[model samples]
Target: MIRVLVVEFTRPDAAAVALGRFLRDEGVEVVHAGPVDTAEQILRTAEQEDPDAVVVLGAEPPSLPGFRVFTTAAEAAEWASGGRSHTADAPSDRAR
Candidate 1:
């Protein structure tokens, strides 16, 4: 199972919570860290959790090497659910 850490950097973290729930339903291990104040804190938490991916909501993701940063929860959920190839959802230009 894929492991992910959901971090909320802004107020009203409902989106982050929803993301965690969705990930859980998809059979992915979801770790939530909240009330995050700084980028350094995010990094520290990530190191401790050691998740495969980190989802940042309501803020820009910190530059963390070797870790995938997702700006939106939906994107993270899709990836966790094995839909990493976004192109699959894109409309085909050719009409068959």
Candidate 2:
């Protein structure tokens, strides 16, 4: 299952909330409502949840130590899913 860390500014937009719900409903292990304000928490949550990647919505980009930014949640989620798409892909470990 692809775990996701969804960050939002003033709560999530409709699509963002729906995205989290859909991911969980689809049996994806999502870190639901993982909204955070600080860049540090975002990084820490990523470390703790060890999500495949993050899906940000309605929030400014944060300067994290080592992370990529995507325009949309779908795009990010797709990028995160790429690792699971191929049989030859290596498993990823959550880093702290």
| Candidate 2 lDDT, 44-69, residue by residue in tens | 77677766656667767676555444
Q: What is the TM-score of each candidate against the true structure?
A: 0.80, 0.66
Segments in model 2 whose C-alpha atoms lie over 4 Å from true places = 10-12, 65-69, 77-88, 94-96
Question: Each candidate: RMSD to true structure?
Answer: 9.2, 3.9
Which residue pairs show collisions in model 2? none
- C-alpha positional error of residue 13 in candidate 2 after TM-score superposition, expressed in Å: 3.0
